[model samples]
Target: MNQTPQAAIYSPVAQIDALMPDIAAPVDAADFPQTILRFRNDRAAASVGLDSLSDEAWIAHFGRFEPLPGTLPRPLALRYHGHQFRHYNPDIGDGRGFLFAQMRDSDGRLMDLGTKGSGQTPYSRFGDGRLTLKGGVREILATEMLEALGVNTSKTLSIIETGEALERNDEPSPTRGAAMVRLSHSHIRIGSFQRAAFLEDRALLEKLTDYALTHLYGEVPGDNPPAQLLGRVVERTADLAASYMVAGFVHGVLNSDNINVTGESFDYGPWRFTPLWDANFTAAYFDHQGLYAFGRQAEAIHWDVAQLAVSLRALVEAAPLIEQLERFPALYAQAMARRFCWRLGVVPGDGADAMIAAAVRGMAMSGTGIDRFFHDWRGGVAREGHDYDDAAWDAFRGAIAGFAGVEDARRHDYWTDAAPCSMHIEEVEAIWSAIDTDDDWAPLHAKVAAIRRMGAAHSECIAAA
Candidate 1:
């Protein structure tokens, strides 16, 4: 790490190279025809003391993939194998993305500036490395909404529309292309461990284990680093799963590759917000079997943790890993209760976990939309709406009766609004339509503003509680 006399903010650390030097291959980014700045997250930039950079400088660093001052000499495309659908695939790695740089935030937390659709790498097989413009817009919307809902998610740092035409089966052909960068807690994934374990690389596994404990978890209470690391990762992953459930979010893809070591959500693709509670609902169109369905997210997370423990078996005894991993169910339940209460603007009481679970069932059975259900039940004060004849709704309401509301929660103007802010598929389409049809960003900007307002209200309620 290097610093100037003025308390330099960009304290670059090649944590990846330090931990697993042989894992990431240094690669050059794709040279696009044009670099047009589509979106700039100044707030995120401010955190890393980069908001002062001009647009050209921002483009030079993020779009053109120029290494930042005192950072890695070149971009590093990470390598790791992951189970795409519970089937181990050793050939996969960073096909279209790469680790651009690493620096510290204002709070002294290390953050990785990872790039997506940056260029083609060795891992990119039969694919042209590029991101669709619509994809970039969706990522921005997902991060913004998830952040507002209090989910642990990566922030979209910047989006640069590189002048290129890309063909994809997921969307329309010859769609616009762009490059995106996300500010994330960690680029290390559960797949990272799987890679080392699969290759019988104990040294790499041990280094990663210790690196996670030092960089991500800070300090563990136990002498056994592997066991303690698994425990903390389980806690955060459980909480992350609960946060998604409460937010009516379907991550669409919960593969081992996407499940990072820190448990913070990233690499948003085919994500969706539920209009109504339905366990079988899924976000990705190609997920025909619904393996990662909305209801099965927690199950998916638990399964991923188990795989992570298997990966951990290479470094330590399986008994400690399994023992620590057993704590996930309880932690998941606690997270569900706490997050549900936070959203409903109510304090947790007896039967909180069961009550929250019942509310999800009640929402489905009563035909109540997810956001509307929360908007109506905020502060434990039921508004005039919903079906009074529904038995499950009545039961849910009764179960939540003893909880008290946070003081002054209802005073926020956002609470009085006609509808709660949501990110349904149609709303997403409409926002993208504005951008695509007319190059109009007003709708997208306005939607973000509204989501932030909702977030502010929820923030105050959580703080007051």
Candidate 2:
């Protein structure tokens, strides 16, 4: 396991092994019959200095589960408990995926590369540890679109088609099998703290909190580690919720396990980008109560944050955690206004919140897709033929008076088209149809290209902030 790191690009830091060793169990990866690389994010790989691998080498390391040089000698399936649909379940853990390696990016960000549908672990219980190829495809599409839309999201690093067939109740049985690797700022979830608190392990809780402070956040105001941690988590989660609202995304499942401490969105399942702004629009099929609907996403995340705070109370007083939790509404409001203005390519002003409210009301009154509404009114100016309720438009115009356009993105080639790139569920199905019927991947490739182009068009908005 002490394989010397051949060169700089492969030498990863074994921080988890040296720091907190009790929360995960090492396991071997399943030996797939074949490894066919279908998707490789060169841009994401480049950031972590992994862009130089040939396809064969990439498959060997990513698909065949060869240990990265100097890092995790073996994959570790993490252990934790989460409240699913507000019901606490103590039995579930990482049954299919595991943390494979850790490395530092160009910006010195501590990035973790984790697997999905890798193999069975101690927590596999009675389930087969495999992922359907279509599921992998959807995740790649979801992560790419979210990142382009300015959400802090996990990057789908590699998706390899494994030579096997998986049976599933949701999709057509005997579906093609696949395994995926994703890169993110951190894999520590709110559920991790919940597990420590559940066990009444005070020492481990402190260790986890301190580890998070030094790794994720650089510097902070307070000395009490637990209070500072909760406050930071609240701030990040608020921003995460706001990003979802601005982009009209329904996460479908806002479980504690899915909420990363870094507030980076990951674990795409039953997700959807709402075409129209409906308060009751839902993405998951089983969500009969609409708990995590489009409009309730912020509330759901706030509830998740509260669970995290409750866990933190084992180490710190409830009052400080409550104080930090109180910041969510205000912080969420600010992030919504800020990100909305960022999308509209307008400079933020004192009236940014009111302006965003007016814009939202107009979208609701126009009965058009939120994407179209934003596109027609990009730069805070209504186009000639795009008129909503006159009163709402008046309110919008009044609220947007002093806010100037940040930059002229119309010069970009992407804006030359009449429409912005969209990821409506229908288009997602069409892209999958070609693959399922004819093994054609052109549509998926083209969509990724178009989405990246849109991101490039709005690069100034992303960078200026």
Which TM-score value belongs to model 2? 0.95
**What is the C-alpha lDDT profile of model 1 across 1-465, one tens digit per residue?**
001112336577777768646679888999999999999988777777778889999999989988888778888888898888788999988999999988887767778999999989999998788899999999999999998888888989999999999999878778889999999998999999899999999888888888888877777445788888898889999999999998999999999988988999999999999888899999999889998999999999889988889988877788999888889999998888888888888887778977887787788787889999899888988877644556867778788877898777677789888888989999999999898889999998898888888887787774322
- The worst-scoring run of ten residues by lDDT in candidate 1 lies at 1-10
lDDT of each: 0.86, 0.84
lDDT of 2 by residue, 1-465 (tens): 001112235437767764557678889999999899999998888878888999989999899989878788989998888999999987878898999999987767788999998988888898788888898999989988888778889999999999899989888878898999998988889998899999998887887787788787865435788889888899999999999988889999999999999899999989999998888999999999999999999999999999999998988789988999999999999898888887787887798887877777777876667878777777767666656537757788888877887767354676556777889899989998999899999999999988887776766453235
* Residue 147 CA displacement from its true place in model 2, Å: 0.7
Model 2 accuracy (lDDT, Cα): 0.84
Clashing pairs in 2: none
Q: Evaluate model 1: give its lDDT.
A: 0.86
